[model samples]
Target: MNASADPLVSIVIPVYNGSNYLAEAIESALSQTYSNIEILVINDGSTDDGKTERVAQSYGSRIRYFSKENGGVASALNMGIEKMAGSFFSWLSHDDLFVSEKIVRQMDALAHAASSESICYSNYYVFTDDPADTVPISLKGVPPEHFRYWLTVENVLHGCTLLIPKAAFTTCGTFNTSLRTTQDYDLWFRMAKKFAFVHVPEMLVKARSHAHQDSHKLAGTALKECDALLSGFVAQLGIDELKAGSGQPGAVSYARVAASMRSRGFVEAGLVATKLCIKHLSGESPYTKVLALFVLTRGALMQYITKPIKGLIPPSVRSTIRQWLAGGTKKGPPGAETVRGMGLKEKFSEVYDKNIFRGSKSRSGEGSDLVQTAVIRREMPRLLRELGIKTLLDAPCGDWYWMRHMDLPVDRYIGADIVEALVAKNREEFGSEKIGFECIDLAEGELPKADLIFSRDCLVHLSFADALKIIANFKRSGATYLLTTTFTARTSNEDLGTGFWRPLNKQLSPFNFPAPMLLINEECTEGLNMFTDKCLGLWKLQDINLQ
Candidate 1:
């Protein structure tokens, strides 16, 4: 197509501390088959090696290079938009690549779209350092009315795949610089409300995933911003009875957003968001309101009630009582005996004193303890050394049986349990200048700071509500890593009543733990005839992404 026949398309490349992949991204933009195109590189004050500036200069007049004070990705893109000479605007990240026909394909798709459609986006591929991990992602185009509702729930459109008409910004406005991570999402959400979005079925972009991406580093801030942005939009679209004559999509969307927030450890914010969801659903959707209220109450009780109850009891009595009441006692089958309607501490304390319960059947040193102890001894030292963990806290240090066998490699190690008797025994048995023991009620007491925390066979014993509180406390304690044995199975979550024993994949499902956990090693007590998939997993508190 001739230059005049085809409208000029401006590609804005926002450069940050991404010199490592800047050249590759620029080459892809410059090599596009679409002739009527201009490439603009906006340097947002990168303090990395001077390679980014030098590389831009190497392109010379072929591409326009603009530098400004360090604002952020949104600021750089806004500046580029201000100086763009093309009628259509598209953003290309410094680490993402555009196929040679990406611009041409989008323009062709735009020809078929309605005049009101101001944005055209195509399917894209996600790739990491490993080529085998690359996969194509597709999105279905929806009408403006439903698109706004979709964006409120989540961002499905990739910014790199979008080509926005210059006129769209007049009504939709430019990127919000105040937002660090959700700038693209926020802008897209706003634009979707006013303009229709057309999705091209073809995959034309390669979005790279790496460790240094802003989304990975600033997850918590991004989640808060997303919540704030969604809250504003949902509030503006009031759910008055006249407006929502039928079922209210706004209320459903808000409920989904609230659930997402809760899954990410934003418990308080999740409750507030859910309340708004319930308000919108009040007169519109009776069934939805009931479900939302149930979810909200369950989550609230888990964090507020169950968590505090666990902590109020001494650690020594905590595990013993739970085991005794649950009938997981190694002594024998618990029979029809029950410990309900009694004081938790008093009943459990009497049971512990009388040796009514030997211990949790799972932890009863019936030779299975040797296997767990050996694994801990083999793994703990290497993990501490590799992760640079200086201090360690072992919660629910159940009798300190297996711990006594492990080699303590950390600079300092502390064993803690709710059982005062167990803590005293541990201190008498192993306390030293480097090794110490404390009586800690994990569910309720203040936790000491440590580089790493090891929680084993604890969460399964508590209700799902109490487990979430303890996990939240672990994050708040400023611990870098969390090591725990998660009980996962092939089937659905097993309801142990107070807490549900989940499959490995469901680990992230309960209470939106702060970080995504890594399954470092799987230990099957199968040799001992156990029916649980007890695997040791590691979670890096620093690596949990906001989304």
Candidate 2:
């Protein structure tokens, strides 16, 4: 294939006595859809006669061949980096095959990227010799820039899955020759600090899993290296990174990381990580402390249960078991269960008990996705500042899952819900001197007084009479203002009973709320844009017609 103006990406295959699959690996590099590329085969010293050399020679001038003492993969890779003519570098293991479109797709992604040193990786397939055993792994859908934050827990990024710019190697330096087991990740960690890595979300490489791999043969060494790597990584890990990566408080993620380290038999490293968890937990509110404790308990439970069960599985069926588990990672759209023939208290009780609103990967539902709440999160602080609002009453605050991550500057926060059990859980896990949880059913009696009522995603589910009763209750509370959910695109109102739901335009018909003081678009992207213009509007309570 003729070269093009596009930047050259060197496909570097470092082999050590790998004639068994060297030719296949070379063939994959040659078959790339991207034409602006060069193939470099580094035959790291092989003691298996000249079989590996013959394999490299058979490729002729199609690949640039070089041989050296078996210094290790890191050394071979460093030699390839020094000798490669391409501006970009891609490492292809002698045993792994790249999908035909890997380079071309990554090149297309880089064309749109703003930074020059930015590296890119993609999802990939892992398999044994049998093609039927292939399993596609999906990486979490985080934006390219934020990947480093989440990389704390990500272990699946294979060397072959990466298409890296050569400049990154120059800037971050090549793989550590001294490290035998973790050179790729060690260098990647260094580069991750200095460069932005993009995730392409497409499966671009098929990795071969075999028993002869170093990780399988030298398990002790690999575990030690992994623990060392984690030791350094955990040392630098701080609250900001955890919050950015997980959208949760620092202590929760720290405890999880600690639990993960301990479960892997790195007891000392795990203890250090636990100290970091405790350091962050120090002086935090009771809510955060309880939440961290809850996370730690859950992690402990998982460790106790899964570790034993994993051991009990037969080696013969481990492959089948893994395949089944890989398939289980995918979750379908959450089913919205019907809550029919139940009382006001029983209706919401069932909703919480059954978790009927499990709409997104988030436990609270799709209404609470970080992206869905992005607009409102940005707007809330400003609204609070402008109104001088010191306290907030979050009605029907189910789970407090998404909101707990938010940093609201309120003097006091009262999370109220209809489910008594949910309220108790919230109070136990999230209540503190400045934060509180209450069992409240708005359809009934007088509401608690607050500077403003931040009632979101509430009115749409209630009957028209119940909504009126809640609105009257809101008025009776003598709160200065209300910020609540409304679908502005909705031209008319459709009334439903307490257990059912449809979009309601508060400005129309029976409600006829005046033009809102502020219409903060919820930017509802939950389902295929069906609920567009669903907004949280702000209004002064006295101006609201309570009749």
Candidate 3:
């Protein structure tokens, strides 16, 4: 096991009732351009569809199959890692796919960097079937100085896209089996504390989004886990240390939890939490006021009762309680209006105006960077330039900041979004003549053509089928280069925030595209790969001819 020897990249795929996509995920790994790879598919107690034997047999001798009673994904991953003989270890979710060059690219990057670098990851694309059709975007690279800071706030590495040296496992310990959620985030956070991180700006993986995925369900449980993890970290490392390592803690963590609950129809619990958050900000002492209010609220109390009651109190009574909750609902769900009415355009505007574009002077004297605008300004130029595109069509361009910050020629920019207000604002700022803004619904109409079709962080809300149709539409638009960012399958219950967790439909299938497709690159950003596996990368259109 000499460090200089040819490193064996062991791909550990943990499967649990993921039989449907298991073949695709395994095929994606075996198809990797990098040679000297081993596939270990650990089946974690799948009882529903006993396709484990069939799946293992399909791969023949290429994949080693291990069947164990239904332990969680983390347990299965740990089992695979323990048995892995490769110098570099990477894990892919059974439902997720990877670009052929993912391992090779990451291995090369790791070999070139200093040995002290604990982990290296590349960008990835999030594939969905959503027809609402928002563009995908990636987070800009954080300075080495800010690496620890970025990681503490969120997991910047996606497990599926991550390649960690064996040494990292020795130092960081195994994934926390007790943690049903946030295990990857916890592992990466611990890794960052001890080692430097490197980023490869390539689309190396595709995190499949579908109905049966864990992220769609168990959002509340995931949120609770994340909050516990964060609180634990704060206690162990101290809030000052966390703030020093990561940037200031924004409202996203809390906001996500609240949003998750609302989406799951836990309206009252979500609202109570939101009010508590507001109260805490408003100088409410003893914060117990919020907790007290939550306990007293009928909705919150019902939520507390439903879990145990459903399990112990019998199905007949549970159904009655559910009916009652639905019937007696007051004050609606948290962020419901925000969720229903706000499209990608509106949400982006809210995030931009309230946070990113606020023109808040940098206290650190790092330039007049708006927190939100800084990520776009620094990353867009390089990303666009790397795509070798002079022209870009920013579909559903919420605010024109992406266009504004891009260094491309004025005539090359075209912006279309559903928000008329934002579209009008864009016309006023960039002038309707130079930058074209259209009020278009990608779901219903035709899209404008361009060299590269760019979108960012816009998929999750739609169903899987709709996401695929959107991609199909993108291909039809005659765009050669497609760049987008999305969440990974590793999303935890905590990651969903307050959103009610729904398990992904087990029957949901992967998007099928013709071959000779070039998957340019993929990476994980946004603290952790909870919701989606990988983020940020350039992809070449393969199956569709953009003529």
Candidate 4:
């Protein structure tokens, strides 16, 4: 802890209106076990009736105080960087506290690391009001190579946990001021690219997660600005032949941002993001660019076709015609009963091929494709927006034809299906930062949690027993709502030669489910003319009071 022998560490606390906990944050840094530490509090124009300024003034000469005009956190940090008198830099937020031994342990790790340029960070504890609520976090299995990939998906690194060498700043530069929420994330990515980040898997800081934090206040606008900053960062990476399409790191990030924008009704922003992705990916993925344009055009055609078709034929007649064309009385497909008893994974793998929807028959809604593309394109997004759903789990995302065009007002989209090849192709071609694909057998495996579970025309293809099991899984999946279209004939579960068909109401009947744990309320969709009895049921689960 000798000042002359040890590297001087600067603990910069950036504050705005953080009068409540600023003193506590400052004291924690001053009491650090590593004595050769300088504490600098940057007051980024606090308008809290001079309260924050007073708090810093009370610290006086013990902590260096600098007051600047109202600037963002990035600017305050940059100012601190310029004035810091230490070779090692650490960011201690005005609301967060550094453990007494945080620096001592980090320095010990760096000494062993033997790399002058290596950045060191440690796990931290997240707490609200109660000490019992503290959760120790350790980022496991995260080496430097995988760090970039994991960071691209989401920012996992905690800011206060970081202990950066001054050389890293000189090499990678400081935070981006334009970025609101993800400035720390941007800086991490920049430094990670050039320097190795050594992880200390021990809790070295106490991060406060409170209501008044900047992140919580600007929650809605944060993602939009973060994506904007990320788009610019990726653009600067300069795509190469080796970095095209999903393989291109920058392209992958852009596509994800675009998908999120599109899902949230920011069509123009999404289009711009898509354009950026195409620009980076076009050099190596010419077909992918063409495919994007083709999907756009096909969406327009489907929208137009469905409008006229809806007007010409009544929905009931359309339903009747569809049934008759499949030979009306067929008992299901040839091996329907055999497939019914098969395991969900094997059954879907054998029957639903990767390119099943690419076939002309599936595209034109021939057999088993009960919900029309028009219904999905027109109704689904509106329904999602109306329900204020921000996350969606679309199982059996078949070709994802209608979804590409729909204005789904969601923040996250996960496509899960039983088809392995289809899931792989989706991961390769369409996976982005906010969008992902997983191969899951609905009857056997657990479903991802979301605000809504969207499975249309999928459950009806299963036998009554298997379908019931799937329903039970959905209830256990912690989803609030299920938006699904069930094939109904006011009858019991029967083999209609196309697959298993059952009455929509009967399947969702409260009496059919287990007691006390599940309370399902079903409401049919109105204004859906075609296949009127082919009802869209919104089933809401109260909760699963698991005994």
Best by lDDT: 2
- Ranked candidates, highest lDDT first: 2, 1, 4, 3
The TM-score measured for candidate 4 stands at 0.49
lDDT of 4 by residue, 1-547 (tens): 6767999999999999888889989988988989898999999999999999999999878999999998799999999999999999999999888888999999988888856678888889876544345668777636654455455444457988889999888889998888777889889878877877888989899887643456534533654665565555444444442144236355554665455444332334555666776665655466655555554433323222222133454444433443343344334433444555566677666555533222354531232233345434434554576578888998777656556656667999998888787688778888998888888888778899899888777766665666666777878888997766653322233332334443333343432422211111112221222222353445575432212
Q: Residues 1-547, candidate 2, lDDT per residue (tens digit)?
A: 3466778989999999999889988999999999988999999999999999999999898999999998999999999999999999999999899999999999888877778668888999876554345668788656654566566565667878888888888788999998888899888878888787888999899887654567534444665787787787777665786667767778877887766665444445566667777888987789999988776654443332222233444433432332233232112223333456566788777767766665455556678877788656655765686588888888878888778866677898888888889889889988899999888887685577789998888888777888898888888888999989876644456566322455677887778898877676554644333354577777898988966
Please identify model 3 stretches exceeding 4 Å from their true place: 1-5, 129-137, 155-157, 237-547
Ranking by TM-score: 1, 2, 4, 3
Q: What local lDDT score does residue 461 receive in model 1, on the 0 to 100 scale?
A: 44
lDDT of 1: 0.66
Residue 154 miss distance in model 4 (angstroms) = 1.8
Q: Give model 2's TM-score versus the native structure.
A: 0.54
Best TM-score goes to which candidate?
Answer: 1
Task: For residue 287, give model 4's deviation from the true position in Å.
Answer: 15
Error of 4 at 210 (Å): 1.5
lDDT of each: 0.66, 0.75, 0.57, 0.65
- lDDT (tens digit, per residue) of candidate 1 on 1-547: 6778999999999998777789989999999999999999999998977778888879999899999989999999999999999999999999999988999999887877776556888889877543244567777765555666555544567899999999888888999999887788778877876777887888899887644566544544654676677666555544442133224365665565555444433445556667787677656567767776665554443222112233454434443443343345422224213443333344334444554433443232232366545444555665677578889999767667667766677889988777667678778988999999887767667888899999876665455656666777777778898887653322223333422222232344544444344443333433222322354567775654323
Candidate 4 total steric clashes: 5
State in Å the error of residue 376, model 1: 22
Of candidate 2, the 10-residue stretch with the lowest lDDT total is 325-334
Any idea what lDDT model 2 has?
Answer: 0.75
> Which tens-of-lDDT digit does each residue in 1-547 have in candidate 3?
2335667889999988776678888888989888788999898998766776577668888988888988798899999988998877899998788888898888788778765565787777655432122123355666554565465444445668789888888988889999987888888778877766788888787776543456434444665676566554433443344334534332222333344343333444455445534433443344444543443344343433332222454434433444345442222232333443455456544544444322335211111234333334434554465456767887657665434544554247788776667678778878655567777766555888788887654443344444566777887787887665532222121112222122221112343222311221132211121112233334565543322
- Listed in order, each prediction's TM-score against the native is 0.57, 0.54, 0.47, 0.49
